[model samples]
Target: MKFAQPLWNDLKCQLQDGFILDTSWTNIYLPNAQILGIGKDITAHKQSKQVLNTQIEQEKLMRNIA
Candidate 1:
C-alpha cells in the first residue's frame, strides 16, 4: 500500500457565473490511488486581513510623520 502526504494550499477557482473563489484546501491521497479533497471559502477573511494590514501600515507612517 502507498499513500501521499496531505496537501494544503490556497487556490482560485472560477465559478459558472464567472465569479472566482478564493479558498483554503486540503487533499488526501489514499492507499488505492484515490484522492479526497476538502475546501473552505476564505475570500472575505483574506480581504479583511489585507485591509487590516494596510491600516496598520498607515498608522505606522502617520506616527512617523508626527
Candidate 2:
C-alpha cells in the first residue's frame, strides 16, 4: 500500500518544541509497510543563536556607555 506524498512530507517535518515521540509497529501478516519521521533543520538553531548574540551585544554596548 502507498500513502499520500504530501502527508508523508508533513509527517517528516512535524517536530515541535517540547514534543515527545514514540514508535511502535504491529505485525499482522501485512505485505509491506513504512514509517516516516521528521525533524527540524540545524539552520533554525543557528539563526536563533545569531539573534541571541545580537541581543547580548546590544546589552553590553549599552552598559559600557552608561
Best by lDDT: 1
Estimate, for each residue in 1-66, the C-alpha lDDT of model 1 and write its tens digit.
Answer: 555566779999899999998998998776689877989999999899999999999999999999
The TM-score between candidate 2 and the true structure equals: 0.39
| Structure candidate 2, residue pairs in collision | 12-38
What are the lDDT figures for the candidates, one per model? 0.89, 0.51
When summed lDDT is taken over every stretch of 10 residues in candidate 2, the lowest stretch is 5-14
Q: How much is the lDDT of residue 10 in candidate 2?
A: 16
Candidate 2 global Cα RMSD: 10.5
Q: State the TM-score for model 1.
A: 0.76
Query: Model 1, residue 14: what's the lDDT?
Result: 94
Q: What would the TM-scores of all predictions be? A: 0.76, 0.39
Per residue, candidate 2 scores C-alpha lDDT tens digits across 1-66 of 773433211122224785443322222333356543444345455558889999999999999999
